[model samples]
Target: MAVATQTMTDEQRKSVALEYLKAFDNAGTTSTGGSILDLFAEDAQVMFPKWGLATGKKEIGQLFTDIGGTLTSIQHHYSEFTWIFSGSDLVVAEGTSHGEHRDGPWRAGVPEWGAGRWCDVFEIRDFLIQRCFIYLDPDYAGRDTARYPWLSQD
Candidate 1:
């Protein structure tokens, strides 16, 4: 006997990733009408900058809670997003965002390097994300400039 294998087209994989992003952007709102965890598998893994890695939904919930509690609002630029596909389970999304953090607000291209830019790598299979790693600068307010003298004081 042979077990069945699941396969997803590139578009299907992209759709799953896009849905994940939409859910994230709509977090705390009724727009998505579902928890973001619904898009992940039972044993999904997520990683974020500064927050580190979280395996399974319970830990993932904690990670999101910690990060979400710090942000007043966040919106990803869907039109400006660049999607890359590996023809497998991997999908990468690079985009800009504008949002208000507890310290202040941030917009893409405002300071160029302060914040609002991010990249997320996802592995989606069976219509659920198995692994997602987020890469970005957590300093939404750009308050860490003291360490870098190159930043303008203005």
Candidate 2:
């Protein structure tokens, strides 16, 4: 039996990765009615550390919606990204994200607000996101002091 898959050039892989990031940034700031989900294939999956695997568009959309509800604002800044092409259809992009999240309660006397880092791995196929595995310190949601003790002005 022969396995078949779609193929994308190196430039196409890079473009898809960038486009996915742009769509994510736009989604965070707009009300486009599930436009974020448009970046994924029909059977895409998202896997996060604590969030298990969200399969298909509906589940994935619900996952993002739930996460969006937790913060008033959030932003992902991709500082570095390294791409690896597996076969012609699979491209794995790994990167670190400098991010900010605010407007919640995650600590005993502190509002949930902090700037942290994230490590993400994205799998792209045919110009769409096929899978995304995100790894990060979810505990960083608490006091910034926990993660940024050097910021003290004392």
Per-residue lDDT of candidate 2, residues 1-154 (tens digit): 1122666677786676666665665654234344777777888888866678999989998888876655544445554566676655556665544334454423222332332445556667666778877766554454445447564433
In candidate 1, what are the lDDT values of residues 1-154, reduced to their tens digit?
A: 1121678887898888888777777773334587888888888999999999999989998998999999888998999999999977899999999989999999988888789999999988888889999999999998898778788555
lDDT: which candidate is best? 1
> Which portions of model 2 miss their true places by more than 4 Å?
1-6, 28-34, 103-115, 140-154
**lDDT on C-alpha atoms for all candidate structures:** 0.86, 0.62
The clash tally of candidate 1 reads: 0
| TM-score, predicted candidate 1 vs. hidden true structure | 0.92
TM-score of 2: 0.66
Judged by whole-model lDDT over C-alpha atoms, candidate 1 comes out at 0.86
